[model samples]
Target: MKCPKCNSEIQTENINIQADIAQCNKCKNIFKISENIEDVIDDNFIVNNKPNGTWYKSDFNKTIIGASTRSPIAFFLVPFMLVWSGGSLGGIYGSQITNGEFNLLLTLAGIPFIIGSIFFWSLALMAIWGKVEVSLDNKGGKVFTGISTIGITKHFLWSDVSSIKEGQANLRYPGGKGVSLVLEGAKRISFGSSLKEERRYYLLRAVKSVMNKNR
Candidate 1:
């Protein structure tokens, strides 16, 4: 198969069946090759230069911009969880208000449900229409998240960041893996929490490469 980055022919000698690693003759990019490399190549199963809306690069420099690739599982799970949790919260809170009894334990127990409901709903919203833009450049890195034309932003200097690594996402059951930036003092900023495993791996590599280059 041709190298995805350079579009050059791959060398047979550089490809090892046992290790499943292939070094592109042109780009020198070492990548994992599935056992069915010929079939995958024929089917165009190689990672695309541009992975839809999840990743991009700037013209000035290799500034990597990553966004969450919406998950199909989130499409189904989020709304159901939202409705269930919201109903439970409403019922419990309403019952307490009507009875004029404030039970601390019940309230505490309900807090998790309430939080879970909001969190999952947010993931659903993100999967449908929400977007988080993560950019890494020579100066530092930035994260922006919001709906189209509206969002929140955060920026961190290179000095402020310790590293970037893969982490488990909050939206666990069906989809919950993501990559996170480890800030100087143990703080973390996570993104791509709903992406598939392959996408997450590519993203983690990109983030790590950029972070390493800058450092």
Candidate 2:
């Protein structure tokens, strides 16, 4: 096949192979080759059949995170702190009533703790659901979080991606094993966990194929 980006001929020779990736000496682009190649590549094409856009879409079949699993120990502490602050206020109020001395200063002391607890809870909830969607298309690529799309910061033509890096790392949560893609421009993207090693390798091959064809 012809290289999609440079119009160079793509020659394949099998070398040391990993579960998910292979090295191509011709144009030197490592990509993923999987069942989802069609879905990841953009449909739009130029007169020469080259992809025209900069975005790629990847749909993960596995669960990223669920509400049940995402709820950390800190989540339950919010209510506890609020209740404790309320109890402190009650204690101060009762002491003032019996002593005939109104201690307004002591009652206000719990306000900061209550506010801080609420803020912590809010942040934890946000972190639990936030996930990055890694995708590729004719336009190029994107990482999506909710309604926001984060574009790949490094600029490289599809021809420039040379290698794929695969490894595992502990993620913050939601996802466990990490899969990474190292492109020619030193741009890298990773996903998955140890539980999905097979899927991760498949994804690596699919990306390698795409990058090779593009380059």
Candidate 3:
């Protein structure tokens, strides 16, 4: 096969699946590709993300990468969650023990507060520690995003996917952008908007390149 970047003859020995990369001797450009290098889009694309705070993984397997969902609003919500959860739980348990009885009216009144607290607290924590992992495997793609094992997973083959591009970001967080996967028709799945631009672009390119390679 010819080098995608330089269009020069590439020796078969230079293409090694185990290495997951190739270097063009003519232009001295490096790239990641499958056996059919010609089908690769932007073969010379470089991923510069490295040592990026707590989420950095020097050994970031190109096939699988995670984007964190951390947000500045989460930090602001920390104090609110503490006070809200304390009040909600304290009222429920205090009434139960003080009256020596689980008053249905008091319990019902506290339930909504408890639920709200839990929901917001969970969202806050997720914003702090949650991550979405995108993988290029199986028929097309697989995505898992969550706080630990308690998140969600999505699976879809390439045939079912129509477009992979940048998606809308949550307006609450300014300057945030997300990656969206549009299915064959109207269905769309979006994730990882809070990530940095370079990270999002890498994900978009990785998926598109693999998809083209499959085709």
Candidate 4:
């Protein structure tokens, strides 16, 4: 195999189960191989191809980074639990209201479940309808919320990005890790809100390195 970016001879440097990480000696382009190479390698070729992620070179020296959209386990589990708990609590509350037993404590207790239902439903809908991506170049980086018209209509270039910080995103019930880009003017924008801890750290390092190189 030849490196897609530099045309250098590709060699298998590491293997694990059905996937192997291949590296190019000339340009140091790395690719993840999961199946027979002959079929996967098309005319356009590719640079990096992780199972649920992507790292590739694009037109005009742009580097694209893709993270997993939704967790496979959370996709079904979250919605199910949200609907179940919301429905059960909502039904009980309704019953209490009818029986003249409604109280502040019950309403307060049900608020969390109602909020969870709304958030999980929104997340599931977004995953089903669109995808998220990040694009970076010599100038700056852009975080795209999703691909639909209603998804991420506007994107701002963070030219003053000084560093990227990693932390937990506690927006939803079972929040995951996130990465935030700290800018020069004390401005911050976060991405990878749904990524795992390790994946978020990896993205943070990758974006930080690219930003440093551009600087």
Candidate 5:
């Protein structure tokens, strides 16, 4: 581009973005760039798909996404367990399951039933006493999943995140897909997507909105 005063050409390569100033090669004239520093703290983050009822908080620069296993499935399991116990105790309970008459082989043969019981019970336990949370900022993010204060946390830099999109898990459950981050190094990070459908999309869009503002 030509300098306004001397009409001498200036190379675009030498411009400083943050400094917002450029120097003319011939005249040594320093001129300010028209660019302005932007602040990402705004309501734009929530205008997109907002969650129906999951917990959320944002301090503008830092966004926190979280949910407890408070799904109705938790409540549903109560009646289910009651009905199962009522039926199972009538005959099968004393007859085989809680009875010493069943041999080790028979007990061993019911491993599938044991596993299924454990799965359902675990789900109920988590629903009553578990939480999953994510903290996102301009530079990095963290995901926490656990019961109460005990759980695992995964950390990642925003630069390492290639993209955020909806991803399907290998499981065969409904709403198995969730917002996931694709890393530059061929790894994937999922923030416990077993949440409701509204929360899933809200998380996807919020992450995208924050990352876009940083850009």
Candidate 6:
């Protein structure tokens, strides 16, 4: 097999009865042979080393729950409905005051404002429930946020990742949530917390594992 780090030929040396470490003879690098290599490796039984720099692929299908799911109702729908109802009520009041004829200029001005509110509200709703897809490749990765089936994709180099920290913290936007991940420097580019605790632990471990192997 080829060494993931340097694309050199990897040779396995038996370390114990049940374990063997794959070492790259050229680069003098070693990585633990994972038991789940079948799922992790590509069609050729080599790790998925795509053009982008990610050693693994993780797709998060986050269910819209809590406040993030309700933000449309609270921030957009409620306010728009209230404003529209108020405008209708105002038009009726103005018509009554003007002896059965509504003021055309007042009603016309309100119409545009109401329409603009609807547009703005729809955009806000779109922003709330948007599905964000984050892809990490060999070069880099990106967070794609939108309602369309295809999510956004971003690319970054391995060197661009300054640091990887692991911990639990409450997240914003969706709110009332805690997440864990191998953070890249100060920027929170992707959602790491969605992974199961064990999976997340391994993900963080994998980041450190690759980093140590590269170093």
| Candidate order, TM-score descending | 3, 5, 1, 4, 6, 2
Error of model 1, residue 155, in angstroms = 3.3
List model 5 lDDT by residue over 23-104, tens digit each: 7788887766552111122345555435655566788678887766457777777678556644544344355755557566
**Root-mean-square deviation of candidate 5:** 10.2
Q: List the global CA lDDT of all models.
A: 0.64, 0.42, 0.62, 0.56, 0.60, 0.45
Can you tell me which runs of candidate 5 are displaced by over 4 Å? Answer: 1-50, 60-62, 82-102, 127-130, 150-152, 174-185, 213-215
TM-score for predicted model 1 compared with the true structure: 0.55
Please give, for residues 1-215, the per-residue lDDT of candidate 2 as tens digits: 33334434445453323444433456676544343233234323211231222123333421111111133433554466557655665576667777889666875875676676555544344334433334455545533333133222333445445555565443433333344434445455443332234334444455554554444
Best by lDDT: 1
Question: Model 4 lDDT vs. the true structure?
Answer: 0.56
Error of 2 at 122 (Å): 9.6
Q: Estimate TM-scores for all models.
A: 0.55, 0.34, 0.63, 0.52, 0.58, 0.37
Q: How far is candidate 1 from the true structure (C-alpha RMSD, Å)?
A: 7.4
Clashes of 3: 2
Q: Itemize residue pairs with steric clashes in candidate 4.
A: none
| Candidate 3's TM-score | 0.63
lDDT string for model 1 (1-215, tens) is 65544556777788786888888887688877873243224212223544665665655664755666476866586678767876898787978998999988889989888887877776677677766566777888787766775666778877777666666564453455443333343446665555666666556555554555566
The candidate that achieves the highest TM-score relative to the unseen native structure: 3
Clashing pairs in 3: 177-193, 178-193
Full candidate order by lDDT, most accurate first: 1, 3, 5, 4, 6, 2
Q: Which parts of model 2 are misplaced by more than 4 Å? A: 1-132, 145-160, 168-170, 178-184, 191-198
